[model samples]
Target: MLEHNDEIRRVKISVRPLVEYVYSSGDIESGFRSVAALHEGTRIHQQVQRMYQEGDLKEVTLKTEMLYADILYQIEGRCDGLILLEDGWMVDEIKSTSSDICFMEEGYPVHWAQAQIYAYIVAKEQGLSQMKIQLTYIQVVSGEVKKFVKSVTFSELESFVWGILASYNPFASLRLDHIRRRDDSIRSMPFPFDSYREGQRKLAGAVYQTVKEGQKLFVKAPTGIGKTVSTLFPSVKAIGEGLLQQLFYLTARTTTRTAAEHALGMMQSKGLHLQAVTLTAKEKICFQEKVSCKKEDCPFADGYYDRINVGIMDMLSNETLMDRTVIEHYARKHQLCPFEFSLDAAYAADAVICDYNYVFDPRVSLKRLFEERKKKTVLLVDEAHNLVDRGREIFSATLGKAEFLELQRGYKGKNNRIHETSRVVNQYFITLKKECGEIKRKLWKELPEELINKLDLFVQEAEQELQGIGHGDAESRQLLLNTYFAAQHMIRISKLYDERYVTYAEVVRNGVSIRMFCMDPSFLLAQAGKGFRSTIFFSATLSPLQYYRDMLGAGEDDYSLSVASPFHREQLDVRIEPLSTRYRDRESTKGSLVRLLSKMVRERQGNYLIFFPSYQYLQDVYDHFSAENSDLATIVQGTGMTEEEREAFLASFRSDNPDTLVGFAVLGGIFSEGIDLQGDRLNGVAVVGVGLPQLGMERDLMKDYFNHIGKNGYDYAYVYPGMNKVQQAGGRLIRSEHDTGILMLVDDRFLQRQYQELLPEEWKE
Candidate 1:
């Protein structure tokens, strides 16, 4: 929807990010700042706009084009109100704040700057020699209003607008140059691979055509068909053709993010000049041992905005690929928070590789992506099978009574308001526990209005405390902050709750817990993906296409493609052990399962990965197998392995190893999918049991909910998800055409009609 002109080298930007960037100064905000909820803010805006005069225009769409530094800038925005003043036109900008407006004698520079831009645009277009600008501030809770007005000549307005443009021109120019050269390279570049491996061309063509038409494409691509490149290549071509300005390669796991980065690297080596940024989670990339955003506590958070533009310019000018290492280098060089720096850099990147949370999670999604940019953006969701569960997590939230109880005690003598609010919340939990009596666990179709009201009050008190009314110790402060975030998240999710959601309460050892569980996330996912030009959800394990389509919010007009496996069927030697590895039979069959794994490894004489349904099962069999074999080389996956430990585990599976190496892992784990160990590095894989999820309240709720909606509830909640993991684990073997490996499916369920039908075509006889 942006007015982009390739010939004119025009840069289209919204009014907000531009002004914020130009006026951005000082430190990254400290941990606690009062941010009104989105809906609350919108309500306040409408409340103010309702007072407009008969001739005054509210939500006025204003736009103007300016030539600055020989680059065209198409700036557009909706002004809060264009007042019909007695003297002339007055451009109004409304801002809602939690703080009192009485102390704010004048308005913020950023607010004034925004009003001035709208005024200038209106003045230039209407042939007015003068214009009035107004800053309307309303205190959110009290509904108190404060207004500041200024009048400037048309020449003065023009000068001010030009200065704003000049400050932003450098960034726009940098992006413009990158796009020009990137497109040039893309126009001449061929596919990165030597040739399309069977289904690759079809997938690539489908992606390109889907993007061109601005629709969604769901793909069930088999493993080893170059799914990454097949998707990325066509998206890159779309960028070259001006069909898209940016693409987000969203993955469910860190390993898959690496795959996307590697795919882009492959294209870059072939002269593709696109600028791509890989965003690592903040916890993994922060320079400090403990992440404290307080300016005094962390050097990187101090005056980050002051140095960020320079850092971004330096990185973009010198490097085309801004991965973690490159980002950290520039971040340290410029004294910037690496995570924040990457986000800033990503705004200008042609492609962004990051986790699905960054794009889909409401609490974490980037707010700076304006509607215009979104209309030109595409989301390529990788390993999409993981998104079903991830989507549920994204739209759900939990609140525990323990945090409130702790806060109630911590703040009792220090602050009465926080103490009282926390006590009230804790007391509500106690009463809810009494209501449950013996059952302990309860579910409801409606929201808990009373708890929500109490949590809202607690959130307000907590926010005031965090704003420095009364200070607490570091530990107390952390607990309060964590509780504040949880309360806010719960409130946010409550707003999204509908018939597809359920409210559940469970009593724990010490206290009670409640969660707003999103039983089906299809509606929310569809809402989140609305503005994008196109979305391509592809995974090697996105089997049972219709099930995924319904769960992933597929539209009626959306296209679905099921690409056949590019690898030959003869390459895989499949076998069914026909053993009982179910939960009830696990102890009875542990010995037989151990022997089967030992025999497979001994027979193959190459590296083999054995996957179990859970860590306990993996350990049980590993203990028995080790007791019998003793001399066999083995490594077992530990719980919560660090990145270095994981690397060491995989590195042990080198192709040059002299003897056979067997790795014990769990299905649907970090090792099960998104890993590539082609050729001699991995020669066999054995998946024990049908990878069914542990039976739980949430899964049962999902099954019941889906069945109520006239679908196979058990399959929707259990069977399909379990089999997806089996497919993903088996997929690790035979990554390429030349690769050959043995696949062993342990458990009698593998031979069952239901499970057999769920297996991938290549895995079936």
Candidate 2:
């Protein structure tokens, strides 16, 4: 909700969330929800609306403001129909559900409350003495309808709405009070740091200007220039100035999340009273060893809605920075799902620290952000370079024949519809496999419409089967649910397919796999980022600023700012070994690479990190380095390392270490970006390659597509992405002005004009 006035403190909210919050109850339904689009319900609504007589109005807008507890709430909503009765007008609210209409009986109380609220607004606005309210429920599939009607005087409607507002008063009061305090603090707060570093004020000014003008800003700020605080400080000030309501600090890695949190905490220590929530991934935060949201298996998920409001109120009232630890603590105290609890709290927060998926990914995005709220919210995307690949991943979808084949076999006698649909989908894949016999790969510019239709039927049947399955049949239910989600993703992506998408089929021994690969996600990214007040994309390695701006969907009028490194050239000892670390030359050059790494570590009696393009290369070189040194302290980053392991790896590079320590990690792995090891903590960084991604069909397809579009095909496909990893890896060194570290680039390609031009000015002689 946005505060519309300064003298009286007016809060604006729509009717749906306002009523649902007060009426929402029952267990958390974390099962397979029907993925039917909302537009289906709208179509049904229009179908019902078309049946009304001539004088009745459809989709009528109603709004009213009520004074409660010294705060004015502007409530507004669109009634489905306003029918002219013989005596007066009746507010008709239409709802569509997938369930049987026969079970609706008198209809839900929330539905009645919503209709009555609209009636209250209408009656109050038009000076009507009384109004009739109707709740109309229709079955989505069968088109069966049920209607429940009630007549209430204006006084009764007024009393009911007052009660609703009373129930919502506690939450509203907290928000109003917090906003007052947060704004006051922001007005009086000084910079968290004693002084801004070089280029910090310039970046911060650019961010503030962008938010002020409601435009996007792309920033190429260096690592040590305090990008996190620089961006966040201005957004916070914007919230205070009433230019924005909230901001989302979006990042791709856990370490960057920590940086944002730290920045917020620094401000909080300086008297800021903003409420910020950090959303953690469900799999990581789930209390269960295995994430099963069934009520019988997880107490935290049972009756979650009943407890969630109270829990959120308590948490928000007491805590300001509700990160994972604080959220988990409150969740346990209230026996609520931590993931859902965090999301609930996030909706009311002044700042949300979360992943890019929450705003960009269609499947998992926070759908509750209404259009009005978005016009006042800003997105500060940290490590914006990572969104290029992350965008590709979120927009793409893949389905294999194995799951459908298993379903066809397993559910043969259990459910014939599931079996038949799965069989049809499986047959489609089999035919595709036969067509790609020798080539083993097939590509198409158009979507696989035939396969998509089959998958849709399969998904519908799987959803019904899942809903009907007993709790004891968890195994079969799990399989059906998994395949249902896959099919849902495929169907969803199919709707987004355009000239930028490519449908590809691959055949292997066991089965055939098909993918709807998103070749250019810029358009989709722009669509997702629309409606927000502004977006700030900042990173240390957003080199080739034009490329990032283009790939990130920057508008022609959007501003781009590049800040110079705060650290001097003398602080970085950069050396190029001019060695070939390409795929084919690895074996022949392994010994030389090992010798160079050993010599660097031997000369520098401090902590060092050597980054390779792949784990295979890391392991191979580590084998030789270990055999040759035999006395060095080394820690190698493993595949899928746990949180504790990653923390321990960073903790190993102690400032007071007795001997030299070297950590071998992959270039784009967790160790590459967002980790800070200042001064003696990290003395040197050795990058073994130019960080080109392995050659593959996807790369080739991307190359061919970009070439066809007249861009530099090779650079767009491989060099840009690869060099980004190298830059991120090298950025780990010289984190602050006081830090001076050696950086070695072992790839021969670094001397080339194309690659040398990509290097940061401070990294070159």
Candidate 3:
């Protein structure tokens, strides 16, 4: 047990005062508690203000801190409201409650503590001796309102706040001690790798420079350079140097997460006593086979905040690397919600390993981690090129009329409010269908603002009805909840909608739907890059660094580094067959492609991978080649390969006494990147076509849009994305210095100057 003092008080202060008490355990119950509460409150407040023209309410302030004893002892709490009292000094605390406020009496201790905290802050700030505090609780389910008001002297409020602070000080002191110890441990940690490779050293140097300059860096380093360790080693050093306090290793896929974990483990093995946690998606990490995230059903979720502190303290004291297995072990032991436990652990972690959504997606971004952009934190976006599409999907929203119609029918008799709200949204979709003239074709234009405004109005009504219901009607309640999220998503997307987005309507089985599809995500990508302390976007094939930098939101002021592949030029046999595999020429070239691919594999007596633009193309060429070369073993990518199937495919590529093995895989699929086939496990790669995307309205529209922006529209929209797949396919050939392989590009376009210019320096003749 430690004694708490004024120094502990200074360090223990909540960065987000209003949310300090909410606890990380609350996140497991249902997403982010503080953000959810704030969102719900804002929604209700907006509705109430629209209905009633009372004196307008305004934000008082946030994270306001007041010194009680010099700079050591302080009182801080975010003021949610500072009501303009026509006469008296009134401090308002707006609360969004799922439970019926009428069920609670006037003197609930939780309510009192909340109001008292606000009153103390207002009284201190306004130089008032006494203040009237109002606790405005709006039922999130019912839209019913309740108010609890009381007047207390500044001295009394001070005493009440001091009591809460006294209890919190013990926890604060413990956290500070832990942080100091962790930082001290990190300071003495050694570089995990015995020797850094040339490429690794270059990448590490770039990361350090980026941090030193406090600017973004886009690095293009080939695979096998130990990208994760190269980036992590430098980032951790930055932490030791007090340049950064936290590092976020964000990845696009699960397989990549394992690589990050492996890298961290290497560092840990090298005596780095850092606290790092890898966050698994809530759906995957949930203890329950299927997660509902309701309090009654989940013992871990019920009263999570009540036990979270103990769980957090216990884990912090006993563990260093809180990986999923460690987290699950601790969570089960302490009866803590594992999903929420991971999030809580992340806040205290020196580094976090997780998916891109944890940082980039608005719906799922770790709100607590990014509260202050200027905070000493660094984001290492892994496989960053994936973000171009992933970001668009995250920021865009789609609502089908079918789901609303089903909800309307489901809730018609039992839940009138919910059913009515569902009907309103359904009607809006119906109106949208009418506006689209019953066409099921893709549209290439901007979404109508008026339509979005109407949807906004519908969102308000649905939110109010959902709030009125609270948590009673399970099925109908869920429908409303889904609608609420959809509406919120639309609201976010509407803000970013511009010429880059194409408005398209589709009709499927008598149902008409409209979408504000993102034709190109470059502009939106640039928007997300803003306000970060720094970002490093690096990949093996950011070959034409200028194209990636331009599309990846790299500013002119942002630094760029291109590290060449360390492997000797002699190791890779790069060949370009001037064969036409263009969409128009596919029929004529199909036989030639199979013959060319067969010859490449026969010449190289080892496992080979043939990458096609689509499953159809892959199957077509695979069938033709398999028919001709029946002696060679072939594995083809199916609609969805199970774990066993994927294993069998890789296992076929034996390293010892390797035979001719050809695996047909689609470009830009899972097999393209992250998989390691070192030495003789894989030898040659034959990439069919330029790997351009299928001719779709979206791709065409993207081409036109970029052409309008003073760029080569075809390359921007089609050629580059296609070439990315081509490059990724080619990258599979080389795994290590000992690995010698051939890369055959089976497309005439690769021989053209426009496409040829984009080839990596090492590949150029």
Candidate 4:
């Protein structure tokens, strides 16, 4: 399917990536990752810019393109600042560093390359004979500033630009060739599926239009509608039409990520030759048992940068569906770090299948991804309802007193810096604990800047200790790594702290811990997608669309669609059993719930799933059910089931499954939602209780916070979210029109008008 054309297409690449690919050279090693560990000087940049005179521009945008042997290279970028000089104009390149200014005396070759390209572009456009290029390095730790200037004639700038282009041209030409072939296949490839079934066509159409219009769309296309392909196919078609350059199918769970990979594989088999790369988590994807990045520990990590480019080129040239296995194959082949290799391959990929955190998380989101690419990229957020809670978790940060106390004790006398910094942080918690002795819990409307400042000092020391990690044992390095990430996370979260965030500290019997909790993740979630071309938030049950719209920060102009269930309501035999399943009544009603579940499964002999609000409640009911109905084959969901165990569990359900199995699963857990069991494999689903979350401080805080903002606090904090889990569990049944099943709503609250209003159109009584 991947065939070369006689002529190559123009590949649009910005200056950052261009210079990085051409001029940068090093082994693939992580730098001191802590944002505060270095003097990034975001504040200093603005402060320095203020000193510039009028007519001098800060953040100047520049563009230039050149054609080389059959390849058109489009290069554009924004310079940090452009100053007006008496002779002409000066290209100001600002860089923040943590090291001493003396090391920066000659300036980095990459920095010079970047500045020279800007100089060349400006000189060529303004018809100038010469230009002054200045490199300003701001030391983040000391706030010390160093400036270097170089004067070059137009001919000198042109020669330097040409030399870099010669190095970059091969990579560009390779990509250009691939794009031409990829576009041809995309333009000619027919719909992979024989046809769209049910409301699949409608879902696909809405997604295509949304991407074309450059807007966000919230789609409520239920399960069994082929949601993955329905969204992917149209987006792939858009790429062929030259409306898009890349697509990111962001998923929340591994099951859904696999589903995306399978969808792309299906298309590829049908003649689609697009490069779709899947990013597995670093910890899981690592080839080593432990992630020790030292050269002595890992061969793949040692010379990663030395081999990564060749690995990327080889992998991209051959593979279309670059899933974890494919990525690992090439990673091992080239002796490159598998995780970092996947990230590099991802930037070059036409489509990326990765987790939501890669795009939205504040601490770990890909930093090198520029806004220009985002302008041509579309985000397909699969199982979007999960993003609400997941977003809350991603944006939240908690620090326990025990971690710092442990570090203080462990590092004492050995590393004075780590010990002193840890002791200071530990002392801060000790003082705060006395103030809250009576309640043991305190809340703050503002972020604790003093604590953050202390953590910043701690991170600085932690990074230093970690640089000598190989000198210590694995445990020591692991401890240092954990604390470093924690401190860095706290710093990152502090920067994003606004009115939507609340800081809380609670002292338990064991230890004291403080948290910066995101009461509403809407603003931060919206902020994460600041530059993306468009986003499509789709799931089988995005019920109460308004709640999702409000919480996901959907604009008024954004599109929303509610596709009718393709299957007839007749296929689902719905029942509303009025019984008390609230936490208060769960104890007394446990036996009755077991009997009801037994009765429902006894009436029909096929696979069934019974969902409860909590695992303890589920276990209690499961214990009673097993006592009474031991004859039926049964499986109970466990806590944190591994990938193999989960697959074997799902594999237990099949069309040829001999027994009428009754699987007891907790609501909102893995099996309760994402997994599918179509046709005779699944016969019924009984969702016990109203699915309200356990009453906790965090939930209460969210409730009170929402109430203060004139919204329905209880519903926002508990009811709707709980019911979303209930609906997802129920949705597992009646996946296809041919599949007939019974759906029983076991909670008395379900019959209430307020709760009934939240039910799906087909499920409501």
**Clashes per candidate (backbone, < 3 Å):** 0, 0, 8, 3
Task: Order the candidate numbers by TM-score, best to worst.
Answer: 1, 2, 4, 3
State residue 395's C-alpha deviation in candidate 2, in Å.
0.5
RMSD to the true structure for each prediction, in A, is 1.6, 1.6, 4.3, 2.9
Q: Estimate every model's Cα lDDT from 0 to 1.
A: 0.89, 0.90, 0.74, 0.85
Ranking by lDDT: 2, 1, 4, 3
- lDDT tens readout by residue for model 4, 1-765: 112356644656677777788754565544346464333567767768888999999988898878777666677888989999998899988887655675556788788889999999999999999999999887666677899999999999999888877876677767777888888889888878898888888889999999999999999887788999999999999998878889999998898898899999898888888999999998899998987676767888776766767888898878889988899999989888888888898888999999999999866687787877788899999999999999999999999888888888887778888889999999999988886779998888998999999998888677657754433456765777787888888888888899889998989996898999999999999999989999999987787998899889899999999888888888999998898987778889888888888899989778899988888988888888999998999998899888898898888888787778998898999987778789988999999988889999889999999999999999999998998998899999987779999999998888789999888888864
TM-score of each: 0.98, 0.97, 0.88, 0.93
lDDT of 4: 0.85
**Which lDDT tens digits does candidate 3 get at residues 138-157?**
77655788887878999998
In the range 85-123, model 2's lDDT, one tens digit per residue, is 888899999987766556556878888889999999989
Q: Which candidate is the best by lDDT?
A: 2
Screening candidate 2 with a backbone cut-off below 3 angstroms (N, C-alpha, C), the clashing residue pairs are none
What tens digits encode model 1's per-residue C-alpha lDDT throughout 330-405? 9999999999999999888899999898889987798788887899999999999889899999999999899888
Candidate 3 lDDT (Cα, 0 to 1): 0.74
Cα error of candidate 4 at position 620, Å = 1.4
Better of 1 and 2 by lDDT: 2
Off by over 4 Å in 3: 1-12, 15-19, 22-77, 81-90, 96-115, 121-131, 138-145, 153-159, 166-171, 434-439, 442-446, 449-454, 457-480, 643-648
